[model samples]
Target chain A: MSERGLLIVLSGPSGVGKGTVRKAIFDSEENDFQYSISMTTRKMREGEVEGVDYYFRTKEEFEAMIEAGEMLEYAQYVGNYYGTPLSYVNQTLDKGKDVFLEIEVQGAEQVKEQVPDGVFIFLTPPDLAELKSRIVGRGTDDHEVIEERMRVAREEIEMMALYDYAVVNDEVPLAVKRIKEIIASEHFRVDRVIGNYIKMLKEM
Target chain B: MSERGLLIVLSGPSGVGKGTVRKAIFDSEENDFQYSISMTTRKMREGEVEGVDYYFRTKEEFEAMIEAGEMLEYAQYVGNYYGTPLSYVNQTLDKGKDVFLEIEVQGAEQVKEQVPDGVFIFLTPPDLAELKSRIVGRGTDDHEVIEERMRVAREEIEMMALYDYAVVNDEVPLAVKRIKEIIASEHFRVDRVIGNYIKMLKEM
Candidate 1:
C-alpha cells in the first residue's frame, strides 16, 4: 500500500443517507478511516459533543480562520457558519489515514478547487419519491420547508456529473459496500502508484 | 443496477499474470462478463481451442476484415495477425453484459481510440524480482527472449499513467477484488448513471 491516504469528499442531496452510510462504513472493520469534523458557528444542541459533533466556534473566530486561509471552504447557511478545516485534513492525511468528508455540493465544489484529485462521490436516493418521503419522515420541517428542500435537492443532484462516482442509497449496507469499493480502487489509481512502481523498477 | 454494461480493457506486461487474474474474475459467479476472443492468423498451437482461444483466420481473411473496418485494432506480432473484433464488443455490451478485453498496451491504446470511455486497467507484479522470476519460471523462452521481455515489460509498465486503474498482482484474490471494485465504481460513474437519475427526478 502507498504511504499516502485517500481524501474522499462524499456529497449528495440533503435527504440522501450520507450520515447513515458514513456510520455504516466506520462501524465496519475500517476503524482507521478518519472523519473530518467541520468547524461551525451553530450552537451545540443538546447531547451534542463539542469535538465529535463539530468544533464549535464563534462567528469572529471562524471568520479569522477564513481570513488566514485555514478553512478549505466556509459557507453561511441559515446564519450559521460551517467550514471544512484545512489543518484537520492535512494533519489527518499526514497521520496516514483515509479522511472522509460529508458535505453539501457547494462545499464539495469549493474543496475541489484546493484538492483537484480528491475522490468525489455523490450518494443519491433511489428515486424522487424516496427522497421526498425521507425528508418528510424527518418531521422536523413543515410543508413549505420540505418543498424548498426538494427544489434545492434537484439542483444539487444536477451537479452529480461533477462527481467521480454516484451510488444509489437504496440500502445502507449496499451503499457502504459501494463506497468501500471506491476507496479500494482509488488506491490502485495510476497517479498514486506510478511513482512507487517506477522507483522499484529502477532499483531492480 | 444500470442497464448498460461496462467495457473493461485489462492490460499489463507479459510476465504479469494477466491471464490468471482474468480467468479468476470470470470463474466467479459473475456470469454477465463476456471475454473477447481475438481473431488471429497465427497457426493454432497445441491444446488451443478454436473460438475460445482465438478466432483462427487466414492472412487473407484477417486482411479483408481490416479493409472492411471490422477489426477495431489489428497487430502483427511475431508474424501473427491478431485483432479485436469490434462487432463482438458492441454485441456483448448491447446485450447488457460487461465485455472484458485482455490485450497488450499497444492494442489497448488502439481500442481506447474507438471506445473512449472503456475502463483500462493495468496489472503489474509487485516488484521487478517477482516479475523476472515469473518470466524465468516459464521455460518456453530463452535468456535472450526473457531479457527482451523484461525491457519491454518496463517500457509497457511506464505507460501505467495512461490507464484508469493499476492493480499489483501480489495475490490472486486481492487483484481480482480490486478489479471487481474498479468495475463496480465504473458503473457508478456519473456519465453512466446521471441520465437515469435525471429522468427519475423529472418524472417525480
Candidate 2:
C-alpha cells in the first residue's frame, strides 16, 4: 500500500536561520518535500516571483479567501496578510509528497489545530548570545530593530513548548540533516503506514 | 545549559533486524549513545560477556532488586528474569548521554509506563512476506518455526498502534540512520530545552 505524505510545520525565532535551513533542505537530494507557497498581501520585493515564492494577492482577494474558508491559517502583520492555502497543501499530500510550511509560532499552532496530524518542528539558535550575534551579523537592521526582534524571539522561544520537536541551528548542514531525518521517520509512523497495509490486506 | 540525553526504546517483532539496526547505530561515529545492558537471570549464552552484554544475576538476586525498587521495569519470560535498572539509566542521562534500550514489546510498554518521557521506536520488516523471508534467511529455523514466528509477527504488527514511531527494517543502514535522526531531533524538543531558559529569565 502506498503511504500518504506528512504535513510539516517549521517555526523558529526570527534570527534562528529558518530560511537558510529551508533552502538547505530544498537543495538536499535525499528529500522530495514540497514547500507550501503562502498567499500574502504584502507587495512583492525584487527577485520574488508570484506563485513561486508566494501567491501575492490584493487585500480584497486575501480577505475574500479568508471569508470563503480557503486559508488553513492566516495572520496579519504590519498591514499585510499571509496565510496557507488548504487545497494546495492537501493536493500535495494526496500525491504522496510531504508539504513543508515555514511559519511563525502562532501560525504553526493554528495549522496544528486544523491539521492535528501535522508534524511541528521548532528551530532555535544555540543560545541567546549566538542569536544576537547572528541578528547583528546580517547587518539588515539597526540596534533598536534588533532589540525589538530579540524581545519577540524571547516570547517565541517560550512558545517552543508547543512544538513536537526542536532542532538547534548550531550547524547549518546538521540542522538540515536532522530535519530531513524527522520527515523520513515520521513517514514510517506505524499508525500511518501499517494502517494502510492492514487495509490493503483486508481488501485482498 | 547542557542538554539532557534521550531515553530511546527500540522494539520490534522477532527477526525484524532490530538487533542489526541497533548495531549499525552503535557503529556510527555520529552516535555517542550507550546501549543499556539488561539484568537477567537467564544463563549466559556463548560469547556473552557479563556487564557488557547483560548483567547475569541469580533468580533470587533479580527478585531482590525488584523488591528493592531498583528495577525500572521487569518481566519474566521462558522461566527467566529480565529487567532494567533505574539507577544505571538515570546515571547515563545525568551525564548528558542518550541511552538505547532494545527490548520486546511487552518490556517496551513497561518501560514507557515507568518513564513516560522515554522515546519509543518500533522497527518492522517491509511486509509479512519479507518478514518470513528474513526469518528463514537466518538459515536456522525450520518451516514450522518460521510459520510460528510469522504468526507472532502479525500479533506484533497489531500492537504497532501503541508506538510513537516505526521504521521498516527493509534496509539495515537506512533504518539505523532514521533512528539516529530521531534521537538527534528529539534533543531539540522545546519542552525539554526552552523551559530552563524561560525559568532562568524569570528568576533574574
Candidate 3:
C-alpha cells in the first residue's frame, strides 16, 4: 500500500530557533518533507520572494481569501493579514509529500480543528534563563523589549502542555534530530498503517 | 531539573518479533530504560536466576502476592501463574528510569486499568504472508499448531486500532530503530516534561 503524506504543525515561543530548525529539516536529505508557504498582506522584505518565501498580497486580496474560507487559519499581526492557504496545503499532500507548517499556538489549534490527524509539536528553550539569554543575545532588542518578549514567552510556554510532543532547543543538532525522528515514527501509527491490512484480511 | 521515567506497555501478535525489538531498546546505551521482569509460578528452567529473568514463586506465594495487592496484572497460562509486580515497576520509575513491560494484550489492558499513565505500543508483522512465514520458519511448531497460531494472529491484528502506536516488523533493525525513536519522542511529551515549568511560572 502507498503511504500518505503527513501534516506536521510546529508551534513554539518566539526566539526558540524554530526557523533554524525548519531550515535544517529542509536541508536534510532524509526528511523529504515539504514546507507550507503562507500568504500575507505584509510587504515583502528586501530578500523575500513572492510564492517562494510567501505569497505576497494586498489587504483586499487577503480579505477576499479569508471571506471565501480559502485560508486554513488567518490573523491580523501588527497591521497586516497573515494566513495559510488551504489550496496550497491540499496540493502538497496530494503529491504524497509530508507538509510542515510553522505557525503560532492559535493558528496551530485552528489547523488541528480542521485536520485532527495533524501532528502537533511544540519547541521549547532548555530553561527560562536560557530563553532570556537567547532573546537578549540576538542584539536586536534592548532590555525593555527583551523583558516584554519574556513576558509573552511565559504565556506561550504555558501552552506547551497542549502539544503532542515537546523538543527543547538547548542544542540545535539534537533538537533537529529528535524532531525528524518524531516525524518518521508518526508515519507508522497503527490506525493509518494497519487499516488496509485489516480490510484485505477481512476480504480473504 | 531531573527527568522522570515513563511506564510503557508493549503488546502485539505472536511472531511479530516484539521480543527482539524490546531487547534492542535495552541493549542501546542511549535508552537507559529498564524492563519489568515478571513473576511466575512456573518451574524455573536451567540458567534462570531469581529476580533477574523472573521472580519464580510457588503457586501459594503467587496467590498471597495477589491477595496482598502486590501484583499489577496476572493471569493463568498453561497452568502457571504469571504476573507483573507493582513494587518492582514503581521502584524503577521512582529512580527516574523508563520501564517497559512486554505482556499479552489482555494483560496490557489490565495494566492500563491500574496505571492509566502507561504508554501502549502495538507491534505487527509487515503482512499476513510474512507473519505465516515467520511462524513456520520457527521450526518448533507443527503444521496444526502453526495454523492455530495464524488464526489467533488474525484476531490480534484486528485489535491494532486500539493501540496508541503500531510498528510494523518489516525488518528487525528498522523495527528496533523505530521503537527507540518512539521512546525518545515520548519522553518529550509536554504534559509530563513541561508541567513543572508551567506550574512554576503560574506560582511566580
Please compute DockQ, using alpha carbons, for every candidate against the native two-chain complex.
Answer: 0.45, 0.44, 0.45
Q: Write the per-residue lDDT of candidate 1 for residues A9-35, one digit (tens) a residue.
A: 998888788888888888988556799
- Give each candidate's fraction of reference contacts reproduced: 0.67, 0.57, 0.63
Candidate 2 local lDDT, A87-190, one digit each (tens): 99999999988999888877988998889888899887676524545446678788898777667657766677778777888899988888887777677666
TM-score against native, each model: 0.83, 0.83, 0.84
What are the lDDT scores of the predictions, listed in order?
Answer: 0.82, 0.81, 0.81
Q: Rank by lDDT, descending?
A: 1, 2, 3
Instruction: Give the lowest summed-lDDT range of ten residues in model 1 chain A.
Output: A127-136
lDDT of 2 by residue, B1-204 (tens): 666788999998777887888888888887788899999999999999999989999999989999998998888999999989989999999998989998888888888888888888988767653553455668787789877765665676676767877777778887887788777767766677776666544543
Clashing pairs in 2: A166-B188
Against the true structure, what is model 2's DockQ?
0.44
Query: What lDDT tens digits, residue by residue, belong to model 1 across residues B66-113?
Result: 999899788999998999988888888988789998888788889888
The C-alpha interface RMSD of every prediction is 4.3, 4.6, 4.1
